[model samples]
Each structure stands twice: as C-alpha cells, then as structure tokens.
Target: MTDILGYRAKFGVLGPSTNTTVQPEMDEMRPAGVTNHYSRIIVDNANALSDETFLKGTALIDQGTVDAVRGVMTCAPDYLVMGMSAITFYGGAKGAEQWQSNIEEVAGVKSFIGSVSVVEAFKAIGGIKKVAFLSPYYPVANTEVRNFLSDYGFETVADHPFRAPTWTAIAEITHKQVREVVEQMNDDNVDAILQVGTNLCMARLAGRLEQELNKPVVAINTATYWHALRANGITDKVSGFGRLLEEL
Candidate 1:
C-alpha cells in the first residue's frame, strides 16, 4: 500500500453552505495522498434567480472565499480547486478565466473550477466541440450555463433544466431523476454528457451513469477532483466513479 499524504496535494474547495455533495464525494473519489479543505458561501435563499439572491450569495462568497484561500494558501497546496460550477460559468469564458485568475491571486497558486475541469476531462478523452448538459438550476441559471459552454466552443447539442430553486431540493434529487434527465435529452450529436451543480449527488453514481449511458458522463465533482489531482502531479487513480478517474 502507498501513502496518500506522501503525495501531499491539498485541494481548496469553494461551495455553497448548503452543498453537501462536493466535499464528501470529492474526498471519496480522491486518490491517496491528497487532502481536501472546504470553504462555503452562504445561500439562505433560493427562490427566484433574482438579483437579490445573487447579490447576497456573491457577497457572502467574497468573504468566505478569501478566508478559504488564505487558509489553504498557508498549507501551500499545489493547486486550488473551485468546487462550485455555477460561479465558474457565471459570465461565460471570460468570467471563468477571470474567476480563475482571482483564485490564483488570492491563493497565490494555480486553480481550476468544476466547469473548466469537466471541459478538460472531455477533451482528455478526445471529446471536444459537442456535449449535452443537465442542470439542476432554474431557467435563468440554465441559460447562463448554456451560454457559458457555448462561449467555450462546446456545442450544446441538448440541455434540460430541473427547475429547482432551493439547494435543499436540489440535494434531495436522486440519481434516478438525474439519469432520467439525461435520457430525455437523447441527443446523438453529443460526444459526452455534462452534469453541473455540485450540490447534486452524482459522484456515487458516476461510473454507473457512464455504463448505462454508454458514453462519457462527467459529473462536476468527479471531474473537478480528477483535474485538481492531475494538476498537482498526483496521478493516483481512483475507482467506482467513471472512466475519467479510472483511466486518466
């Protein structure tokens, strides 16, 4: 057996306070020798995708993320992993790059987001240009994600929104429902399926989803963790997730 901390790669994860999936799922999927720490943005409300919710969440996020970065930087982790998918794709390609830069500035180290990681994961498997997306956000958030992917040159061959507003509800959503959403899209043009919203539970079922879909289905949490580990030169492979971690 090998020592997990021998690799000594620390991951800084930024997620909503209500997010229960990213931390545990990422930890479980993470290979040996890597340690993960979390920072949370307060999201007390989840009604409409109104400016108020966005403002409050963003403000809380600013404060929370700074603390997270500072703490993680002290540990001198090789890379920072922004675990929130929504923030990554909030302003499209430019927004993603800007956010990554901000993380780098704050942490004084390189960073990657769930959105960017999944894109890289797809490309690693020779998947580029086309993909299907499944989101657990409302219409406004859904549109934002679609535009973001488009800006990155990924064709949104199909997309569907779960129309969920609250994080509690989103977290309650089962893997079966998630799989159903993917099946509903049924787009043959897409080379892979991407599911966003790290709050949702998908890591536990990532390998199963790929097996059932007969194509690559990259979960936000799984891909982000995978990329973060690889970015830090820790190539330990994990199991029970999907082909990406199993083979990448």
Candidate 2:
C-alpha cells in the first residue's frame, strides 16, 4: 500500500547545523499529507558575533549548502525550502534570485527561499508597504535585510537586532526578548512586523502577536513554508502559525 502521509508532497529543508528552531517550527506547521526532510549545513566557526564574523558564517553555510542539497535530493522532495534567512537576505532581490537559481540548478528542484518568501508574504497581505522587523543578526546583516526590503519597494520603519555572538547563541534568545522587540517595533506607521532568522523561534509568537497587535506578524519559517506549499498548489489552511498560513 502507498504511504498516505507525505503522499501529497515532500519538502527538503536546508538550515545551519547550529540552528535549533527551524526544524521544530516547520514540523509544527506540517499538514497531514505533507512531510519535511531537513539537512543541516555545517557552521564550525561560531564564535564572536560581529558583522564580519556573521558574514563569514554565512559563507561557511554557502560552502556546505550544495552538498547538503545534494544529500537531501535523494529524498526526491517536491520542493526545497531554505530554513536560514541571513544568506537569502544578504544581497537584496536580484542577489536572492541568483542564489535561488543556483541552488535549483545544483539540486534540480525549485525552491522557496527566505528573502523571496517574505516579499511574497507581504504582497499577499494586501501589498503591505511599511514594516518593522526583528532579527538575530549583526548590524551588517540587518542592513542587508533593510536593503532587501527596500529593493522590493517595502519601507522598513523600525528594526531590532539581537546580535547573537554565535550561531548556537541565536537559538538561546528568549521569547521575552522577542516580545519586547516586537513591542518596540510595533507602531501605526508600520503595516506589519517581521521576524527573520530561522533559529530565533518566533513562529508561534508571531501568531499570538498578530492577534494582539491586529496586524501581520510574520516569522521567516512560516513565510517560507507557506510559500513552498502555495507555490506547489497546496492550499491547506494551517492554523496556529499566523494569518499567512491560516488565512492566506
């Protein structure tokens, strides 16, 4: 008999080895007929958190990603979803497009990347123009995110960076810290609140905050997953992740 679970689609998710949030969050959002398979890219030098070091870490992630994708391709997933956000947001829209094209060329599969997914999510939410966001990145990465948004015609009204010293440390950020940042970023000027960084554990929090703020609060993991599903024509309205998945 054919397996019923994951019979509809299988997704291959790639993330950093030090990340502890993406897998669990993605697992929570999975529907009955969908399955997610993950491959972790190595991050051997996860010391000192600075713009330079963060970029170096991203380079390391890039180095391992092709191999990781090749390994996961054995599963023959219907699509690829990048569970990491920093690399995707590094070079704005054109850069992200090139990155996705390269990955697809290597893996022989289409992908829903973090940077592109966020842009699409904002568009789906009625073309939200102004946004505030939080990230567990260094100042340089934050700047890249802002630039990325700007390229897509979205204005960033406010942003907060956790500046975690190591990739592992990113997962240690407390939910209390996230709430405070969300509160700081929330205002009438911004149309939405966005949370980048896959290891920050903001999926459920984004959902709850959306109800409180009466605006969209989106986590990267949620956006990427929702994008992958919808791109493949899976319109399953997943609950408890956020309005992006539940209502869009």
TM-score of each: 0.88, 0.97
| lDDT tens readout by residue for model 2, 158-217 | 999899888888889999999988887788898999999999998998899999999999
lDDT of 1 by residue, 1-248 (tens): 43357457667776777778888887787666677777666556455355456444545554567666786666566677777777677788888888788878877878888778877887787756788888776656667788887877788888887755566677888877987888887567778888888888887676887898788888888888888777777777788889888898
Residue ranges of candidate 2 with Cα displaced over 4 Å: 1-4
- Report per-prediction Cα RMSD to one decimal: 2.9, 1.3
Report the C-alpha displacement of residue 156, candidate 1, in angstroms.
Answer: 0.5
Q: Candidate 1 at residue 60, lDDT?
A: 59
Per-residue error for 18 in candidate 1, Å, reads 1.1
Off by over 4 Å in 1: 1-7, 49-63
Identify the candidate with maximal TM-score. Answer: 2
